[model samples]
Every structure is written in structure tokens, then in C-alpha cells.
Target: MESMEPGTVRPGGRTARVRTAVLQAAGDILAERGYSHLDLADIARRAGVGKTTVYRRWGTVTGLVADLLADMAEQSLPRTETGSLLGDLKANARLVQRTLADSRQGPLFKAVIAAATGEARTAEALRHFYDVRVDEWAPCVQQAIDRGEVPEGTDTHEVIRAVSAPLYYRLLAGGGRIDVAAADRAAEAAATAARAGVFLSEGRPR
Candidate 1:
């Protein structure tokens, strides 16, 4: 179909297999060498799919990368709940730390981030991916509000962002090891700030 992309392959024996293979190859290339070196023919060869299929399906590098991001988001683990706000935040921060510190995922994220800076489509795709992640985790902040642990009017998404902000800062700045200690510290800081009514403004992290 004219509207078909690499991500829209219907579930079946061959179609699912093709999508799985192509996406796997694309992820591997992204994790191993970054997005700058991605090519349809190369991905096709690596995936054992045809170049015509890759070219016709994905259309462009941006489309391919965007679809890859979607796949990553879909494949990501669900949020872990820990009852208390601090507990949830610590879990959240630890997840972020581990992901950013991972050999494959870290480089893959960095590559996508780097690509996003120069490409509007990639940037939008990246933003959407983060939006989905934020929405997924925001229920914890809402639960905190329900429990009266944080102030009313706290930005739920912003609270989640706060937990991830420091880790991303260290990741981009290459400042430290981004270890478990850093994760706990970030969680503590976000929880402290949230409880202090810092992120009360809508959609803004103070």
C-alpha cells in the first residue's frame, strides 16, 4: 500500500519476520556504529531482506530512524511501581541510569540524540518517544498527588523529567560515571523538589 512503512507490517509468518529482521538489523547498526552510517542497502544486506523492500518501505533515512525509535519505545519495559513517591522515583531513576550506562542502549540513545539535533523529523520523533515514556511514568506522580505526598497542581510529566534530567546532563556532558549513586541522588533531588512544590507549574520543571 502507498501508506505502508517499515513499522506497519501486519502480523503473519513472513511479514512479521521481515519487520523483525529489518528492525533488528537497524537497531544493531544504530547501536554499533550510530545513525550516520545507516544505509538502506546495508540494512537490507544485514537483515537479509531486499534493498527494494527497505527502500520502498522506509523511503528515507529519517523515516527509517523514526520507525526504529518507535520500535524501541514499543519494546521498552513497562514502568515499575513502588507505592511511595520516593520509592517510585528511585526506581525510575535507577532504570534511567542503567539504560544510559548500558553498552548497547547507551550508544544507541546517544546516536539517536545526536541525529535528532540536526534533523527536524528526527527531533520530532525523539520528542514523541519521550512523550510516550513520560506519559507512561506520569501515573506515579499522579498517585503521589492522590496520596497528598506532593503539592496540588504539580506537573506530572515534569516530575518524571526531573528524575531523568540529571542523568541526561551527565550523559551529554560526560561528567561522571552515571552510577547507581548518581541515580539515587537524582531521585532524591526530584522527590525533594517535588515535595517542595517546585514543579507546581503546568508542564514546567522548576
Candidate 2:
């Protein structure tokens, strides 16, 4: 028998329903309370599933959180192509800003981030989530390079990261507004930097 990893969602039917319910319950708890308050049994009760099922499927809280992060990445919106680098980056930044500013999503992210600080598994999951998102948007920078907007060899991944970093900082550390204006500014700054070769990879002549 193959060993299934915790939080790995099986395809449709009872298993899918169970996974959906359990993950939904977990997200609700994280949003309403926090990671410390997450209990498999409590989630099972909220999800209307058996405690043994939750325990067997997700043996630990970190495992459950990891699965939750995976689910989030899978459900995240696909990138928008607007025929230009700045337009695409602003779209990316605005998406990030809206998520961070969302009433439910904002708090949920804060809880996950705090949990990740002390938990290695959670931190890894968080990194993977961001990686998935970065991969989705990095192509825009490459497209810009093809069009001669940004310099050739501009680190596309870094440019994408720069667009979101200030937005995340506002959510986590800055305690400032994560608004459309801020999103536009982040996008503009990253675009300007990319054009200037600030995100060039090593050995690429500036």
C-alpha cells in the first residue's frame, strides 16, 4: 500500500468532500482563532467528520497547515497578461494588495505567517506558496525582455518578488495601508528597477 502524505487531497467522491470540509474547517479556525487553537478533533467536529479520520489523514498541525498552503497555491488566480510589463506587474501587485487587505484573507495570512515563524514545516510550506505565485508571474518579465522593455537577463523572478515585497511588508511589518496606490507604486518601482538592470543576474553587465 502506498503511504499517502498528510493533507494530500484525493480526487473526487467521499474523499474529496472530506478533504474540502476539513480544510475549510481548518481555515476557519485559523482565521477566527489562530494556529494555537487548531485541533484536529475540533476541526473534525466543525467539518462534521470523525476525529479519527482527521487524525489519520493529517497527523499533526504542521502537516495540516502545509496541506492548507498547498491547497491555497492550487486555488490562486492565474496571472493576467496585459501586453506590457508595467501593466502586468500592476495587476500582480493589485492582486496581492487586495488579498492582504481582505477582511478574512488578511487575518488568515497573518495567523499563518506567525505560525511559520516558529515552525519549520509551516515556513517551508509558506515558501512554497510564494514560489508557486512567483512562478506564475515571472513570465511577464521575460515577455518584457523579449519586447525590449526590461534589460536582457533581468532576473525575472526577482522582479516579480520586488513587486510583492512592499505589499507583504505592509501586511506584516509596516502596518500601513495596502491600497491600490501602494500596489501601483510597487509595480512602478519594480518596473523601473528592472529597466535599469537592478535585477540583473550575476555576470550580466549593467
| Tens-digit lDDT track of model 1 for 1-206 | 00112234446698678877887788779889989899989999999999999999899989988987777666565687999999999988888888888776777788889999999999988888888788888999999999999988899989999998889888888978889999999999999999999989866454
Name the best candidate (by lDDT). 2
How far residue 121's Cα lies from its native spot in candidate 1, in Å, is: 1.0
Query: Could you tally the backbone clashes for each prediction?
Result: 0, 0
Off by over 4 Å in 2: 1-11
Which residue pairs collide, candidate 2?
none
lDDT of each: 0.83, 0.88
TM-score attained by model 2:
0.93
Q: How much is 185 displaced in model 2, in angstroms?
A: 0.9
lDDT of 2 by residue, 29-70 (tens): 998998999999999999999999999999998999999888
Q: Listing every candidate in turn, what is its Cα RMSD in Å to the true structure after a full C-alpha superposition? A: 5.4, 5.3
RMSD of candidate 2 to the truth, in angstroms, is 5.3
Scanning candidate 2 in windows of ten residues, the lowest lDDT window is: 1-10
